[model samples]
Target: MEDIAEAAAYGVAAPSAASSGAVRRPAAAPVAAGAPPGMAAAPAAPAPPMAGGLAAAAPPSAPRTAPPAEAAPVMGGVLQKEALGLVEIVPFRGVRRTMARHMAESVAKQAQVTTMDEADVTIIKRIREKERTVAAERGVRLTYLAFAIKACTAALKRFPRLNAVLKESGEEFVLKRYYNIGIAIDTKSGLVVPNIKAADTKSIFEIAAEIVDLVDRAEQRHLGVDELHGGTFTITNYGAIGGVYATPVINYPEVAILGMGRVRELPVVHEGKVLTRLLLPLSLTFDHQLIDGAEAARFLNLVMSYLEDPDLLLLEGA
Candidate 1:
């Protein structure tokens, strides 16, 4: 409270000092013509000199001048339409403004490029179909998001370049050996991405449990500052919001971000036969200055492979 008050007080002028180093008296207002002798206004005395032999100070008040007349409207005297009646301004404050600045900086600083692809998630769908019941038994909801997180972590281990940050000097890449995937959660306050640390070592069930807890707490606004930082990679699933595909902006400092779109059954050609398979749209946006288009495509392929074949994830002991 004191800090806020101090900040507000900053730039405000203090009371003018008098000759005796006391508060200066305000000049009297003008008196009426018929005022009594005692009520007559006296001429203000010249300001006294400083004790250090400086010149006399000037009067605090200056003569007031009339403001300039309003300028005439230009363009052949034509008047502009007033949209102020319909326009409304809602203040963007606190974390919302911070989020906006962060996004703007990310767009301004990185040479972003998005490469999109669709993944055949029939295998992950089948696994989730069986695990949902087991997850319910353990009091956790098994979601495709958990599977996506697992797949992303595995892919990061294989393509570690995507899991690194480029230094400001652009001389070297700071490759992070640890895998921490920030999960973008939509909360009442706004969007917040609190990452899961050491995500590569966690299993599907464990990741699902953490997802449930992190999302619950994130929505409740109980997540600490520590939970919001140190992400090696980020994943934003617009699937829940019914978006098919979007070019998600890369989270700053991190080389890349993977956007997951809504999963639906689509007719795809499978070995000379058209069959309906559950497909998930993936949009991988990366810093072109750090990773090439080919590398981004390969990274997306590895992630898709993990989702397309659940056995690989299990064989890796995830």
Candidate 2:
């Protein structure tokens, strides 16, 4: 009857003919803006029936809500099927394979411990600026890395434990008498570590020139096996690539590796005055089995001392 039809028009349960009572549908609450997550607005109700049995026009529907922010990036990997399927298989080859094996072996063999520190190198930077033209005259490109190499060699000589290697038999360790400092370089093939023979005896300018030659030869894959092996200590300058700090892995067999980060100028309290200074970040990763944390810290401090005062480097024959 009319009452039942009226109830049905509003999507409410119709009353039986025996009851014939009008049933009412409650209006759903409007969804508030910026509702908590996992909530959605209710749909608009259908229009009521008119007197002539024609239904009235329905009210406008609520706007569809956007999906949650967390669920919308690339549609939860539903749009990114490339990862789910076999995209391409490129196995390591040649130098890449060698690098992979060596890196894995180094990680498996050594118990690595990393320590971080920053050094004020404002004076060193100023010295480099003044000596840049002199270095250019000698066909040597002056760089912070050259200074770091000099500092590291001095530190290694001072803290010989850091420049030592643990024996494979686990009975004793060897402290190298000569300094063959490895300089890690990135080539097209992979990472190449070519060491400078007797790095401790070389002057800053000589080391800089050797670094250039080693890098050029390394990239060309023309370095001898002697250059690759016999590295008593290693240094990697990730600062060249803009890395601030990193827990660098040790070049296996060598007890420690020094990682240099980018130099950033920041305000510091020096001599009761707030002044900006160039600060270099350093990371030292060492084999814990061979070198203790305290020993590593002292070694890093010595390196920083030479860098902070370029005078120390000159006094040390750098």
Candidate 3:
């Protein structure tokens, strides 16, 4: 009774348990001397020391690894199992398989870093508007992506390091003198990047027409294998799907990848006056092993400059 009174004086839980004819439990362990009333409960008692501290631990369960059954047809890695679920189960192959493998390789091999910025594309927007009808008359659909490609290659020329690929041997970076820019196109089957060879030398209208042809052929899954190779750089415009900004993965073998976001009108201060300017979000993901943060920022700034004053591309892109 006196012990219970002393415990109650400290405002802590009293140590009580079932009396006779009731279930029993271990007594509450002692709180430390000078421990506050609401201090944490005492830790459970340690297990009894193993005999000689050398008792044998049970052997680890057999390691589970991917099956290596290749005695028959169908090369290894594909398991033929019975379907046992309500959800759909399909083989991981085809374009989706290729995409998964490449993406995994890129993430595993390269040190990818994404730098984001907004470009004031107001001037290019106006130019695109004026040329829209003209391009249609010539059987082409001029898009801002064409102008963006022009501007990007112009910037790439100045930053040759970002336009190169590190050799598979990792001994050297192969700087591509000519630009073969890959554009990622989403199709019903999967994503395919068929590059425009010598894209830097082509005019905006040419690029626009090529983009249309590539997209059409890609949708029909008719792009030639050669058309998808030999790219030095890649660009993916998630803007068509309404993305504002994103960290895009590098297209392996190439050192960098750039993503374009939707152009939206926003008010901004330009040359001492406020105006509604068309802004495009740009994401530049580069291999950090080759390009540093400052270099990436400078390269993106140059691209943004061309976007802000698109007339400059005419001088450099040609």
Candidate 4:
């Protein structure tokens, strides 16, 4: 089973006959003459209407069409829509069987636990409170997830290797260049991770808006293939459902997954005196294959620092 699982991970075999049977290659469209390789032909234009007996005279300044000899060369390339239709699928061979067995044995598997310090998100809550009205005017809801996503983006920028994939072929891991942050949404059917592409470039409001739309589509099970691919890092807010300090399973392929637990009032020492503060539990599960415990702690610390004083994040963006 272990060998089969490893083989499946490397795309060596299908997970099962049923899973393998689901793989299908999309059909390609015809190419046109003079079109670039892989490019489809442009659609033909409609013919001009026939002249009538009382047709209006042409304008004096009307420009004449240039002859083909003087026409600029047409730059042709395959349309992404057409290319997407030609995607090839490799059947999952080994992982499906192991995945099924793991699902059944999940309760019995000993969880690898690691507890990080709680983050005081009072400032984050305050910012959301202050921006809720303005955000609504912009047609985007201000949520903690937006702030979390921003923090993750900034942290990943500082620590690029954290955004990597683990492969057994080499001792080294592959670090991803683009930042596509995936947010895990729980649906009635199962879990889904819809990614926000080029997340580092979006504003906090934009991130919040996209997150809301993604979650809505996920719940409705209307997400497309593009929304569910190319995740360099993942954030799962299990806290939304009232879970506290859970060791979440790593979303395979991505090196790190950040989990947020419920926020609650807790006593903490500040300015030499104990004070009650609203704190959030954050759990970061990282692939040991890509990052060590120390680096993971630092990444989590960076996120915690931003949450503690979200004003810093706002100023950084400014």
What TM-score, computed on C-alpha atoms, does each candidate reach? 0.73, 0.73, 0.72, 0.64
Q: Candidate 1: list runs displaced more than 4 Å.
A: 1-84
Compared with the true structure, what per-residue lDDT tens digits does model 2 show for residues 14-70?
A: 122121223223433445556664355556467789999999987675696644332
Model 3 / residue 238 / CA error / Å: 0.7
Q: State the lDDT of candidate 1 residue by residue for 1-318, as single tens digits.
A: 432332222224211111122222444455534566337446766677788988677756655444334333332232332546222223454444556677898998899999999989987778778777898998898778888899988888888889999898889999899999899988655677889989988888898999888998876666766677889999998888988889998889898999999999989898899999999999999999999899999999989988888789889875
**How many clashing residue pairs, candidate 4?**
5
Scored by lDDT, the top model is: 2
Deviation (Å) of 212 in candidate 2: 0.8
* CA shift of 52, model 2, Å: 44
lDDT of 4 by residue, 220-281 (tens): 65676667678999898999999778777666666677889998988899779999888989
Query: What is the descending lDDT order?
Result: 2, 3, 1, 4
How much is 58 displaced in model 4, in angstroms?
A: 99
Query: Which residue pairs in model 3 clash with each other?
Result: none
**Better TM-score candidate (1, 4):** 1
Model 2 misplaced regions, further than 4 Å? 1-83, 316-318
Each prediction's RMSD over C-alphas, in Å, is 17.0, 20.4, 23.5, 20.2
How does model 1 fare in lDDT?
Answer: 0.78
Q: Find the 10 residues in a row with the least total lDDT in model 1.
A: 13-22
Worst 10 residues of 2 by lDDT: 11-20
Give the Å shift of residue 249 in candidate 3.
0.8
